[model samples]
Every structure is written in C-alpha cells, then in structure tokens.
Target: MSSVGDLGKVKRVETDVVKCKSCGGTMVFDPATQSLKCEHCGNTEVLSRDTNVLERDILEGFEKAARFDRGEQASFKCSNCGAVVMLGADESAAVCPFCSTPIIVKEEYFGGLKPQVILPFKFSADAASDFAKRWAKRRLFAPRKFKKTLSPENMHGVYEPAFTFDSKTRSTYRGRVGDRHTRVVGSGKNRHTETYIVYRNVSGTFDKFFDDVLVANNSNFDQKKLSSLLPFALNEQCVYEKKFLSGYMSEVYQKDVKDGWTDAKKIIDANLYSAIKSTLHCDVVDYLDISTEHSDVKYKYILLPVYFSNYRYNKKDYNLMINGSNGKTSGKTPISPWRVLFAVLIGVALLALFIYLYSFAE
Candidate 1:
C-alpha cells in the first residue's frame, strides 16, 4: 500500500543470497530436494512451503498496490529482445535467457506490482532439457537433424510472470437454440430421411463463482502456449520470498493489472457461454446474448517456472518452452520438406490404387 515516491527513497536492493550455516558458500533453491542447497558443500536447508496466498481486492489493488519501481530491487533489460529480467545481487553479467544475448548488470527502474506468490521450479535445468528433447522427438514433421542437434546446455530457468483472478459473476442470458430431428420426407424410392431443426427461445439467469483464472503477463509468452502448460499446481504456491528467487531470473511483467483483468474476463466469458449452452442441452445454437455482472473480484500477481531454449537450424531459429513445474513442453521445430513430400506421394498412390481396383470390379 505504499506509493512509488514514498518507497523509492529506500534504494537498497533485495538480495537473493542465502548463506549456508555450515559453510560460507552461497546456497540456491534446489528442485531435487525442494530445499536450499549449498553450492560448495552438500548442505540442504528446508524452506517453509507456505500456502497462505492472499488475493487483493481489485479496487484496492488499483489504488494502493505495491510497485516494484519503489527501488527495492534492480532489473536488467535485454537490448536485443526487450526482455527485462531480475538477477541475483552478486551476479554482474548474464545472458538473455530468451535470445541468448549477452547482457550486463544495468540498474534500470522497473515499475509494476510486485509478485504476491511464487511457484518455484520443481525440476532442474537438465530435467527440463530432457523434457524438451522428448517433445521434439514426438514432432512427426520435424527434421531429424534438428532433433539430434538440440543442446540441453542452452536451457535457462526463468520465473515467468502471470496474473490469476477470482470473481463472483451473475449473468442473464436470452437466446434461441435448436435441436435436430430426422423424419421420412416422401414415399417409396423418394422416401428419404431429412433432418430438421426445432428452434426454441430460451432465457435464464446463471450465477457462478470462478476461481484462479490465470492470464499470462508477459507478451513473449502467449496465452496459447501458457494454456498448453496448464495445471500448474497453484495450490502448492508459496508466499513471495526473495529466497525462492535464488538461482533463477524472474521476468518483469509486460501487462498491467487492468490489462490482465481484461484478458481474464474474456476467458471467463467464453467459459460462461459454454456452461450456459451445456445447461440448455441444445445441438445447435442460433444466438445467445449474455449480460454478466462481476462482483467481489480479487486478483493475485504470481510467478511460474519455465525453461526456454533457442536453437538455430540453417538460417532460421526455433524455440522451445518447457514447464518447470511439470514436464509439459511447447515449441516450434524445423520441418523436413522431403518427409512431407514423401507422405503426399504415398497418399496419392494409395488413392489411385483404390480407384483402379473399384473400376476393375465394375
């Protein structure tokens, strides 16, 4: 609830360095043990898996949400891809995880709402790379060399930004729906079955409470790709802590709270339409107009784990995104034109043979 000017006076950046009690070495959050492990010595420290996540009221967030530009931490922006990333305090130089461009420690001011909760990475970078490799192998059209040339060492762990909203909605809808019916239309040889639609006017009131409608806050991470990596185990999210961000780069959110809520509403409206249609139990829908009122709206700004790898084949570049919490992967891969041509030829040959056999039978 602090204003940007009020909080900007404190210029101390929050550091992610958690020193080991046994050894003086730096410790990082290790997914293998779900704890902080010392890099020098093999000492592990358990972190409290706090599940008491808070959702701020939409009105309150608009007025008094904490802004990151208050100077609590510094971020680095990539000149090549325009990605803003936050790094550990001790780190001075890092490569842009998205584009593999070398970036220096540039203390740039980032203005946005600080994350309220974080879903730490559940797997290591090596595991994410393995997931990407398996996913690429399943691409039927992908070139063979592209699959074999995938480098796991290029994988980078990043905490992607997102917004999840909860809302109670009441909707009044009016529409006309139709159901199909088959009937005998004629007599003898002319008698044939014809399909007709029975239309009826329907109107109803629907009341529903939607929880955890997530919208991606980064422009580079599109909604389609984010949806493909669904079921992020949001129940396991922990309260935002600097320690959770250790050993990983967190992307600054590109979309604001207002824009994020707008996107969330679109998702909610689609869902509402489907629910209403299902309740009507109609085969086809002619028209439906729904007027919805959203109340008691709440939202949470959170971060999710993702691994990205950019690979170049020939003169073009292909990218892969792996879900750090789960093993789900989505990305583009180079396709083999020769393989596609061979499949087309086989299809044509099969069709010609089938026609020749039918003519011979006649």
Candidate 2:
C-alpha cells in the first residue's frame, strides 16, 4: 500500500503479482477463505494487507459520474493471462475466461473518471473453487454428475463497481403503533377477548447522519447478489490510484452518480426510519408516514473484488460468486436427487448390516 509517485498516500496496490510458477496461471481473488488461489491447478499464495486509506466526498463523486462517458472493454491484453480480448458493451471481465488468467490491462484514462478507493481482493481462484464445492455439497436436490463436473475454470475474478455515500438528513414523520393483549372471558369453554386502541396525532422530526451507504455503480450485478459481498473494509480504502488497476480489469461506474446517490439515500432512509421508529419505544410497529430531505451528501467510487463462475446443469446455467476481500461465498448450484437418494440408501444399508451382525453374534 505504499504510495508511489502521483498515486499519493491514497493509493493501494498488490506489490507482487500472484502467479502459479508450475502452470503460470494468474492467481485470482477467491471469496471463500480470503486468499489468492490459482484455479487452473490447486495452489495458494500469501498476500499481506496494508490498511492505510482515505475517503471521498460521496456527492462530488456522483456529480463527476454525470460528466463521465460509458467505457467499453475495447481491445486489451490481460497482464495475468496474456489474452488480447474484446467484450460486449455490458461485460467487464478482469481475466481471460478461456485460459483462466488475469488479462485486464489498465487503461491510461478509463472514461475520465478515476476510482477514489479500492477493496483489493484477498481470496484466490483455488479457494473460490473450494468454496463452490463446499457450497455445492450442501445442495441436496442438485445433480451428482453436475456436482462432480463442477469446474473451477469456469470462474472469473471481476472488479465490480460501486459508490459509497455519506450524508446528513432530517425527516418529518407521522406514524401509528399498536400492541395486542388478550383477556379470557367466559364459561367452562374459555373465550378470548381482543381489544383495539388507535394511536393518533403522532408527528416528530427524525434526524440521522449516514456514514457509508452503498449504491451500485454498475448495473450488471444484482443488488441481492452484490450485497452478499459486504464488509468492504472501507477503513483500508485509499484515494484514486492507477497502480491498483495495473494487473486487474476494472468496470466503469455505469450507474451515474445521481442514480447511485439516490439509491444510497433510499437505503439510508429505510434504515433511518427503522431507527427512528424503534427509538420511539413502541411495543408494536405500524403505519409510517415519513418524508426525508438530504443535505451534504458525499460519495466515493470503488472497485471491489469478486470471484464469478458460471456452470450449466440440466440445460440451465448458474452463476456463483464469492467476496474477494473476505471470502464470503454466495451463488446458486445445481441440485441432484440421485445423490441424496444414494446417501440415504447407504445409511439404511449400514444400519441393516449392523443389526444383522448383532443378531449373528447373539
């Protein structure tokens, strides 16, 4: 993470390239176990972390996002895998999909907008495949052949883009809350009586400050899927530096700053309302009428690491993802009913054999 030249104190980079000397396969970020793993063949390498970093004004980052042009994955060679590649308008692949090597070469000027901070990948490709296997093993209904055929080579490490926002807000709210209690009334057969009381004339000003609310700067990744890759260690974030992008392919922030900020505000408002409503100290939660206004909104654009894999089973394809920083794994795997049945049958056979042996001994 040491600063070099114009990258200043805010830039962080992997000092050494993770390579598999045996196969020369580029090491990729793996979400499971948080390590640098070579997927072509099972190999793991050590990576050190330097947490010194900086923060950006979330709003300004968004404004710049407005002036930026959408960048395409033009002809470029991968530093990790040595692939001279081209991609569709939507794709932002970091490595060569065929060779399983990192291929994304840094652009001198990637659409004019530069990343403010980065979440360097800690996990390697081999670890990501292991994560996939562990994840696959739990799928009781998944196909056995597909499980065995699950290839780690199908996975790629892509740098997903996002904008984190910080803001101060004040909201005016009016809401109703209710609590239920029952009373027993009656004969030999017990009957329950329910009572209702309404809350009215509720109004208050809710003010809360948000430090880091996330917004997807890229449209490709699903919010649910993207959110699975959390705990970005924003504390380790540094200012915009090109060195970090040297050997990795990065995605341009597709969603403009306005959209990102709006998204961030929405997330913040939802949490803020929940906080305010809970702070009201009501036993039951209900009808909420709240309006929020944003002030002093700030933001940062970042490239976070992830291991992505796609597999086909039963004519359907599944995408699996792992968090590059901490190895938190998420993705759908094919289920096999045969495997489940076989496992159950084996258990039953073992029990029967044990009983027969006991009888013979007697």
Candidate 3:
C-alpha cells in the first residue's frame, strides 16, 4: 500500500513556522538552553518529553523485505561518480556538496511512515562548527586548505530518520563439531599427528531483546561510517515534535519502517546468531547453517539527531559526522599530498645519510 508521504507532490515544501506567539519572531531549538528560544522575538517555548515508551523488536525476514524510498526528499543522481545525494535543511547544499556536482532538489515519491520520535538539536551550528575545527586539527594528514576552508558554514545539523528493533529468536541447526588434539605417533621420531572427529547434531532455543537495532533513513551516507558516530542519546529521545525542527535543517524519512524494518532484522539476526553461539560456547564448528523465527515483534519510528559535513580535497570526498545528542565524533578524513610527500622525502634523505656513514665504517 502507498503511504501518505508518497502521494504528495514529491517536491518538499519548506514551511514557515510561526514564532512563539508570546514573542513575535523566529523560534528555534537552543542547544545550550536545551529549549526553543526566539532570538529576535525573545519567546521562550519549552519542550516537554512525553511519558510514552517505544517498542524494540525483530521483524521477520527483514533482509528480504522491500527496499524503497518514501518521504519528502529530492534524489540527486551523480552521473560522474554514480552517487545518489540527498540534502537537509541545515545543509548549505551548493552542489553534490561533497563531490562538487551541481545539485538541485526535485520532489519525488517516498513510501515510509513518519517518524514517531525525535531527539532534537542539542548540538547547534556553532557547536558543530567548533567540533569540525577541532576534528580537522587532530587530523595530522589532512590538507591545510581542506581543513581551513571547510568551515562550519559547510556544516549542518540534520535530523536523519532510522528504525530500531528488538526480537526473540529460536534457531534449529545441524552441523559438524570439531575438537583439536595432537597424538604422538612414533616414540623414536617423536612425531605428532593431528586427528579430527565430527559431532553430528545441534539444536537450541535462544532469546535476546535488542534495543535500538538501527537502520538508517538516509542513503547518501554509508551505514558503517555513520554507525561509527553512534549512541545518539536515544534514551533521552522524545516523540517526534516539529517544534524541534524549527530553524534547523533536517530531512524527513526517505526510508520507511517497512523497508527499514527489513534492515533492522538483519542486524537482529546477526545478534541472534551471536546469542545462539554464546549459548553454545563451543570451541570449533564446521558447515554451520541456522534458521530462526521471530515473535512478539514491536517497532518504533524515530528521528535521530546527526550533524553532517563533507569536504572535497585532492579530488576525493571526505565525509565527517558528529553525534547530535552528545559531543562524540567519528568519520574518515583525507590526508594531504604534501604531508605524505614531505615525509617520504625526509625518510629517503635519512636512508642516504645512513648508507654514506656505513660505507666509511666499512
């Protein structure tokens, strides 16, 4: 079935939010204040955390499920690099932004449920900028221009959507088990020979509850790279409140629960396999295949917070991420060509000096 998000004219419409009526001006989420504050209007709008709870569970056949995009997003396809791009509100999208490919947001169909929870901007533009600067400083190999020019103006706090899941699993399996031991064959030679015997049958029931089995809503960012900057203060996360999105740049879910749930299940199943293996706790095994079934599954749609920025240096794109909830940071950085060349030259010169000194000693 088509979702409500997919039916709209794909072009995302930026809505004009009203200021806190008490104070007449733009109201936005303030990280330091941890509340919505109006700068021009001086309206103090407070956010309340709902007492409602979210469910986390493993959905059946998560990997095999439909992978589709559904929400208000402009899909950018880069013919130069075969990269598809998406932009958010805080993003000062100039081009491919990362690859410098000229980008234009065009509306399109998105087939996903709206997020139920959101962790608002606890980290602001200034915070993100400072974080980026410190991050560049730590990167010893990063190009000077890339770090200096890649200002916070290039940074944006984007609310990326994701699904977290939990599950109970029962797995049945039959495989060969191997135990390693060495036996002395000849007393005179003292030679040792290794032997193996396979154990036939294995079956077990395993259960584990997963919290925040996350599947990303954004496709532009690599999942592994994104996960490196994790633990998005999900516990403090509240139900999706638009008031949080005010004055910030963020993207709605392009990937829905149905599709995201599929990704979530793969994560759960891997955990399930680990749980089952942990339950077994055996030394060695061969030809292992296990099938699992899931039950009592529940899911929550959440908009997790993230700060994203990408820089292009020496014709390669470097993406950086910051955890929006806490100040934790993670991502890949580009090394400067000059730095590498200079190091190599110094090493070569040292080697030449060492050879000359060795010749004199000889």
Candidate 4:
C-alpha cells in the first residue's frame, strides 16, 4: 500500500498490492480462507478484519467524501461497450467480461465515491457456478439442450456498487377502504344474493425506522437485477479496504449520492405503503394517499460481491447472476415451447373433465 506524505507537498496516490514474503509473488484474496493467498506458492496470509463499519450523514454529502487518486490506480475502458473497469493493483491487462473485448490497463483516474463498507465474497467462483447450474436444472421450462450446454467459464466475479440508506420516517396518510358484504334480497323465486362494499374514510399517522435499505448505484447493475439476488447479509459488512478487491474487478458507481438517496426513498415509500395498507384491515382499498417525511438520514456507499455470467441459446442471450456472499442464483432462461404447450394442453383437459363431471351431476 502506498503511503501518504505531507498533503501540502505531495498528492496522495494509493496502491494496494499484497506480496508473499516467502516467494515474493503477488497474493490475491482467497474467498475459501478469507485471506490473501499466493497464487504461485500457495502461501496464505491472514487479513485483519475490521468490524467498525460506519455510516455517513447524508447532509454532509460527497463534498467531504474521500476519492482515489487516478494516477496510481489501474483502470480500463472498453471501446466496444463503454464499460470502465477497475483492476486490482497487481493486474495489468484483462478481457472485458461484459463484451469479451481485450483491455489493456491504463493509469487514468476514474472519479467516484470510495466505498465505505464491503461484503466480501464468501464463496469461490467454482461454487458459484455449481449453484447456478443447480438453479438452471430446477427451471422446469428451460430447454434441455441449453441446460446441458451451459458453460461456467463465462462467469466473472465483480464487486457491484450500491448505496445502503438508513432513515427514520413519519407518515400521515388518508385513504378510503372497503369491506365486502354479501346480502340476500327479494323473496321466493326472485330471491338473489348481492355483494356490496362498505367504504369509509381513514386517516392515521405512522412512524417507522428503516435500516440498510440497499439501492444499486450502478446503471449497468440496476435495482431489478439486484433485487433478484435478495437477502444479502448486510450485517456481515466490514470496513472498506482495497485488499478485499484483490483478484476481482470493481465497478465505479455512475449514480451519485443524492440520486441514490432518491431511489432509496422510493423503496422506503413502497414498504410504508404496504405497512399502512395492512394496518387498515380492509377487504379492498379504493384509493390511498400518503405523505411522508424522512429524518435522520444516513447513507453508506457499499460494494456487494456478485458473479455475472450469460448464456446464449437460439440467438437470444440470457443473463445470470450469483450472489458471491451466498450461493443464491438468479438468471433468465429460455423456455421450451414444447413443454409449455404440453402443460397448457394438460390444464385444458383437466378443466374440460371438471366441467363435464359438474354438468353430469346437475
């Protein structure tokens, strides 16, 4: 790691490269051992784990946030797809995992907020691939040929960027809700049953505290993709250190802090709406309007471990993601048309048989 001299005299250039003491070879972070392992000599070095992860005040914003100096860190820009990837200190060149374009390392600074905390990968790449394969086999509609031919070599580990927000919210809501009531009307042969809703106005105040509401800060890795790999163990996050990024590529967050907070508020509002609706205890909701105020807002810029891979079948590409922290897998798969048609035919046959039996009984 590069050391900082006098701030007034020299600019700080940080570089983190772990080397094995015995063989003098580059050592990368090993997920299996949660330590630095020399690739050439198989020597392992323990990493000092820091549990003091702190959250930053949203009001302070990015102006006071620390940034990396571009002159020393290695980065590469893909000309084909316009992806900027940051490499580990020991790497000089790599293939673009997004587009398969060859990238030569360049020493240019990519400015973005440094991560405050990171959920380091808990499993190795081979384990992630196995999890993906198991998930694919469980997809009943997936094509057999596609499943058989799925390749794990395409998988790549990436430290996807995201922002986790914490806030206390107070909401005042007004809504009309209804309960269904069934009644028998008329007499004799003209008697019939009618269903009606009893609607009433409702207003209430709700207070709640949200912790670690995660919002993806990279455009390429959107919220939908992130949500599919749900339930990350955010409590396991450690203080951010460049050593954790060894042997993996990290993405720079394109979305800024303010924008990230805006996204987080949306998620919070959605949860608040659900909670408020549940409290009403109505059979139906005509309409609901809620006004909320967020207070004591805090945010942490964090990096999540994820494995990205894609499979192409019949000229269509299906993307796959595996949670590196856990073995959970999520992805798109091509459906077998024949299997779908067979299922639909069986469903129709069952429905027809049920109707025939009912008519016969009548």
Estimated TM-score for each candidate: 0.80, 0.72, 0.73, 0.80
Residue range 249-331, candidate 1, lDDT tens digits: 66666666777889999999999999999999999999999999999999988888888888788899888888888888988
- What is the C-alpha lDDT profile of model 3 across 1-362, one tens digit per residue? 01122323443422334356775555667877878787676778777867476664434334324434434344444433545455443221223434433322222232224457887777676788788778778887877877775566777666676666666566776555565556657666786676665455666555566656777766754467557877677778777666766555555555545766677778777776666665565667765677877667667767666777877876777777888888677777887788989989999999999999999999
Candidate 1 runs further than 4 Å off: 1-16, 65-111, 341-362
Residue-level lDDT of model 2, residues 1-362, one tens digit each, is 11123322221211234567678765664434445567678787545544554455655564565433324323444454554445434333344445545533334334546666777766556767777778777777777665665465655667777877777898998888766556667757676676665554467998888887777766667567788777666665555444344235566667777777777777887798779878776667668788898887777777787777877877898877877666677877776767778899999999999999999999
lDDT of 1 at 267: 99
What global local distance difference test value does model 4 have?
Answer: 0.77
Better of 1 and 2 by lDDT: 1
Deviation (Å) of 267 in candidate 1 = 0.5
Error of 1 at 171 (Å): 1.3
TM-score between model 4 and native: 0.80
What overall lDDT, based on C-alpha atoms, would model 1 receive against the true structure?
0.77
Q: What is candidate 4's lDDT per residue for 1-362, written digit by digit as tens? A: 12222334333222334567999766777899999888779999888889898898998765644444444344445555665555544333344557544333333444546678989999887787788889888898888876765455666888888999999999999989999999999999999999999999999999999999999977667999899998898878999877777777676666677888889999999999999999999999999999999999999888899888877878898888998888788888899999899889999999999999999999
Residue pairs whose backbone atoms clash in candidate 1? none
**lDDT of candidate 2 at residue 134, scale 0 to 100:** 80
RMSD of 3: 8.3
Rank by lDDT, descending?
4, 1, 2, 3
Instruction: Give me candidate 1's TM-score against the actual structure.
Output: 0.80
